[model samples]
Target: MGTLFGTDGIRGRVNQYPMTPEMALRIGKTAAVFFRDKTSHKHPKIVIGRDTRLSGGMIESALVSGLCSQGADTYLADVLPTPGVAHLTTHLAADAGIVVSASHNPFYDNGIKFFNSRGFKLSDALENDMELWILDDHKKPPVIEDKAIGKIFPVSDAGMIYSNFLLNALPPDIKTRIGGMKIVLDCSNGATSTIAPNLFSRLGVEVIPLSTSPDGININDACGSQYPETLAKKVLASGSDIGFAFDGDGDRLIAVDETGNILTGDQLIAIFARFYHQHHLMENQTVVTTVMSNMGLGKALSDMQVTHLKTTVGDRYVMEQMVASGAHLGGEDSGHIIFLDAHTTGDGILAALQFLRVLVSENTVASQLANVMTVFPQILMNVTVNAKPAISDIKGLPEAITIIEKQLGDTGRVLIRYSGTQPMCRIMVEASTKTEATHFCGQLTEIIKIQIGT
Candidate 1:
């Protein structure tokens, strides 16, 4: 990660350091110069999309001014999801795409993420180069004159366009595969508020929508994928067969079954893996997942005779591994799923539809599908820190982790890392029993807090 970028992208509280409008202008300028030089286009075309945050308009305006001033034409895909921006970037053959969203963060927070012309996230080297350009003191944005100035175009009906794109990508029997299902959708009152309702309605299912109203500040407030309990309760009250919750930018998905039981992404992945292997739906009998995925998923995949690959915590890392291994499917435990055959990035809505396909094709309920994996007892705890020090340098932290790892041996694992986006440390422990996992995680939590607590 760069000084201004995280594992995902550039994110922070609105109006703060890198997220401020002034910084957004610099980012736009840097992107215009960087992509224009990399691509052969004299007047590079860039697409800009954003979630429904109050600061979105402010950021987009500043970015546009910078890009236009730098001689790059910009297309505005207002209030669209992150993946929608990716799709638009490729669909319009633009030089690159930029999304102004903080994803699952609150409305008070905002972010910027870039996608190349091929609709994939920029690599660390590319981001680092852009960061260097943005911070370079001697370099200045060129002043264009006359007809050389760039223009801004509005990508009207962007939501509908992306919806149609997703629908068209499904199988010919998609309607039959997902027809007549009763479902609940929690859009998190963010980017998917409009797109999800419009997209899911075409599938012939009775959809009960919740949290679709975005008041700017309400995005991800005790709802969405972060709190599947909200969707679970609604599913039970509405008597829906299943429910799905999407984060602010519609890149992650968490689900609720007919029994109001929330299913983890690992569980859903296992179900998909088993079905694809039985039906021979996968082009490569391989699936990519992050290290955060439950160990049970690997066991289940092994039993089903499928190749499983693990990457770092981020979706970009998962995507890189998928590409390298020629795997068509990849995702994280937090619900960011990628179907590389259909889309270049992780898409929550598309994953939901694909999950629906499995449900109907097998003629079963989500509660039963969840049985594909038996989750190992796991606990993830985050501790706010005054400063982020290397975990190895924190006194007693490494020794404690070592002790736990030795005790765990083959039955479990311990992973401790700092949050790439926040000023905190996360401790994750998985063990054969819930009690053991909890005990070990508690020990690490206290150690982290004592070492760097505020």
Candidate 2:
């Protein structure tokens, strides 16, 4: 169980060291005991959900066995989005919720993350304690009598309940104006395959679904948020007003305009930030995003006098900054938008709904709305590394950055960091032109590859 947790939670290729069934069982036992002791609920209870990965059932069974052994009555939300699991945990009054997924990753990769009773990620302190407990060799789950053993129950209406709750968050005016909109959805053949279509139909929109059939291994196979070209083409061919591509777990969204151009999350954030500021919807006139966001977003938000607070790469870090600053709107370039005024965590459908509302209310097309910010030409490159190391400690990397910084000046920026969930160093360079960005990125990529690339 050595440092099984990452920026989000425990994730790896299924059947591997920390991602194996044994580790999952230990995690289940530890979480069951930890959250059980901390909750004010009448009894120890937990809700478990998963995406459409083939290994989901294997890990889910292991988790259930461990939870039941420790007498945590487990509710199984068979195939639900990560955010839906969070909602069910809070609504069902469970002590905690665990989602089995590797958002946006391939089907072979799976992960387990938890939400507290309030539908929020477990605090770092809680996670640390749980990790320590899981790692302790002397700690073992106590055997319970048959009568005291926890039982498993199914949440048959989890999708419906979550969808209705999302709809309820919308105002009457937007809801009324949103009808008659024709939209396309590429579900990524994962958790949102059914739920997103169902939710959109409830809003009286004509739904055109793509990649909705999940065959376990097909999830995120060049068909999701990470690959929106297919969705963009469909929107053009079908003549739909807009298209949305959701990641495997449905916590991220990448949208395509009517012109078949995929809109970056930075563009979407710029739109929302300006709209929130104009409508006085911003809690502190702030919009928080990751450092990976396009520089243009910062310039646009700054021009409009909206505070553009930047955090580290992870959505967890973004959420922390947003909560600390009381910002109502925050997102990432990866499309993990968190609307504090709506749901607790990032919900792709919820963000899509809000974006659609803006489209309707402003009486503008998505392409025009997206033009709220100019997207700076950016290039992102990833290098596989043999081991993780502090970026500051990477020899020669700092000097190279300083030199590149001098060259770019005020027109652009560069960001280099390790992926929290993968063994890769991501290099992002933004410049006034793609040629300049590529040159800068190539320089950094070679240095990192020479230092640590596998």
User: Using TM-score as the measure, which candidate wins?
Assistant: 1
What Cα-based lDDT does every candidate model obtain?
0.90, 0.89
- Candidate 1: tens digits of C-alpha lDDT, residues 1-454: 8798899989898888878999999889888988999788889999999998889999999999999988999999899999999999999999999999989888899999999999999998998988888889788777778688789999898888899888987787866668677899999999999889877887888889989999888999988999889899989999999999999999998899999998888887888788878888787899999888999999999988889999888999999999999998889989999989899999999899889888888888999999989999999999999998788999998899999999999999999888888777889999999999999999999988887998
Runs with alpha carbons beyond 4 Å of true place in candidate 1: none
Which 10-residue window of candidate 2 scores lowest in summed lDDT?
1-10
* Whole-structure CA lDDT of model 1: 0.90
Q: What is the TM-score of each predicted model, taking all chains together?
A: 0.98, 0.97
Using lDDT, give the best candidate's number. Answer: 1
Scored by lDDT, model 2 comes in at 0.89
TM-score of structure candidate 2: 0.97
lDDT of 2 by residue, 1-454 (tens): 1376787888899999789999888888887788778877545889999999999999999999888888889999999999899889989988889999999889999999989888888667777888899989898767767787788999899988888888988888899888898999999999999999988998899999999999999999999899999999999999999999999999999999999989877888888887888787886899999989998989899899888899888777788888899998898999999998787888888889989978987899999998788889999999999977888888899999999999999999989988878778999999999999999999999999999999
